[model samples]
Target chain A: MCTYRTTTLTVAGSGKGAEGWFPVTDASVYFDHPVHAPADHTLNVDLRNPSRGASARVAVELDPVSARALALAILDMLDSAPAGLVDAATPSGVPPAG
Target chain B: MTPGDLTAETVTITGHGGDAVEAYLAQPLAGPPAGGVVVIHHMPGYDAGTKEIVRKFAANGYPAIMPNLYFREAPGASPDDAAAVARAAGGVPDERLVGDVAGALGHLRALPGSNGKVATIGYCSGGRQSFLAACSLDLDAAVDCYGAFVLTAPPDEFPLQVGPLGHLVGDLSCPMLGLFGADDKYPGPEEVAEFEAALGRAGKDVEFHSYEGAGHAFFNTDRPSFRPEAANDGWERIWEFFGRHLSA
Candidate 1:
């Protein structure tokens, strides 16, 4: 089944793609058929630069459980960092774009 | 061009508001004035598997073409990347899809060997699009391979650009063949029955088969969802359906 469920957002970050590091202005998260994964469906993310060709993307397809775990791990890693280490880039009251 | 010899190539054709779009064209070696088919690729985009389907049509003596629905969004990029871009762009608009199909039909008819007959077959998301094209155009035949969202709407959170097309049943211009899996949820047995009832009420010529123990995407050979038993029988049904309507 084509899940067609998608969430897209604009982000400010640098992602290393096939060519190298490029500024990624867009992110798309969807649970649907994977391009390369062996499973029928996956939680997939694409960090991309629309100005660049579509090839300018870093993508990952993870199963639902792994995707949830990865999300928690990301929060955990951020929380464990020294106070203000990650927040130095952005002042309080402004949430991270991604 | 010999009838049995076949070749496939990428070409450019006018599409969707006269845009020059990349497309795959496969033709038998010699122009045998044969019928044509337009294959609409699944949501995975115009990838390798879809190309193989176009080639298979040519080998079976039908000239076929598949317009790269994502060419405008991600030209020269990989199929997966292009698909991502297209998906982020809110999927293909219904008007654009109709225009692309019309362009492909024109290209096929211009062939020296065209028999002036055309049919369409689409899998997954393309399945619903195939029905849309058949309803919107003067097509002779159409095959819907487990197309969802034709009779039911996706959850509101999904915001899929498509909507239920039950209202269009009155406009269908051709005979239709639907192949489905009994276990598929998107257009499970209940939805399929609703679609059939609509077709019946419209007094349209249609045939549908729902396989037992099979689920969504049962025809996708690459995915784990592939069910050989269902796919084989589905293919046989497709050939027979096309043979009846596509032949001169």
Candidate 2:
């Protein structure tokens, strides 16, 4: 089994999938779960009041090869999710978008 | 070109309907504009962060221009209103976007200190605009940071779909650097494959890199989605690619 260090990152915004932007809320979630479980791991991302908003959750283990790849995935999410798709005007929370 | 000196100026240029595009232009205070860079804004419109990006470029000795691409649309329409606009104009033809980009290029060339050699760099919606500029404009290079594609299908098209970017590769004249995240739904394996295939066929130089463990929109520092490592890598690549193709 591979050793993994997990850190939760807060993301606040509004939409469905990864395209949701315009976050009125301060949302936070761990960028990746401890997938050192050897194989693949599944983590649940709960977005507070997601309602028609974009929701995306990915579990990545910080391995030698996967580090850069995972970092790029986060960038892609930000690239696709512009600030126009969200509905929250002044959101303040760090819950995962379920 | 001064390594760190920067000059900022506000300029207005004619836009569609003769509506002026008010932009903040920046470049190294000491050098002739090595090349022109039109920085496209995110979908939410121009904000303080967007302005900061322009200044960063100016400080780097590149004449950077960030136009209000959404100035013709709603003024940062509220969340409730944004949905309606996306539903309505989201399907707008790419040709229209090309025209707008052309207008921006025209303005950049007309700047008293500009040298006319130009490149396009876009973020999010601006990413799409950057790619479109590469397709239609005679740009020297292009940097597309996780831009969505125009598959020309219905609104239900999945971000993973590859059919939309077919035309983009077909029309590309210059090399492009596509920065994406491996876990992003928009640039899933299928989409990357499609772009790779297109680049192979066109014999165009295209570099596609995906950062693992990251999700969508990770390059924007103003938001929590920012991944410092990935953003730095992408930014480094952008500068290298531009220097290789645009700089003498």
DockQ of each model vs. true complex = 0.67, 0.03
Q: In model 2, how large is the Cα lDDT of residue B150? A: 33
DockQ of 2: 0.03
Model 1, B210: alpha-carbon shift in Å?
1.0
What is the RMSD of candidate 1?
A: 2.8
User: Which pairs clash inside model 1?
Assistant: B1-B30, B2-B30, B5-B29, B33-B113
Q: Write model 2 residue lDDT over B1-248, tens digit each, in one string.
A: 44788888767766555667666688777865577788876654566677888888777767787766554444343322332232223422455556666777788777666766788888765666687778887988888777655333312422122235556677787888888777765556566667767777988888888888665567767554678888899889988887787674
Q: What would the TM-scores of all predictions be?
A: 0.95, 0.64
| Tens digits of lDDT, candidate 1, B1-248 | 55457989999989989999899999988755788999999999999999998998898889999999989998988999999999988888889999999999999999887999999999999999999999999999999999999987665656455787888999999999999999998778999999998999999999999999899989888888999999999989988998899888
How would you class the docking of model 2? Answer: incorrect
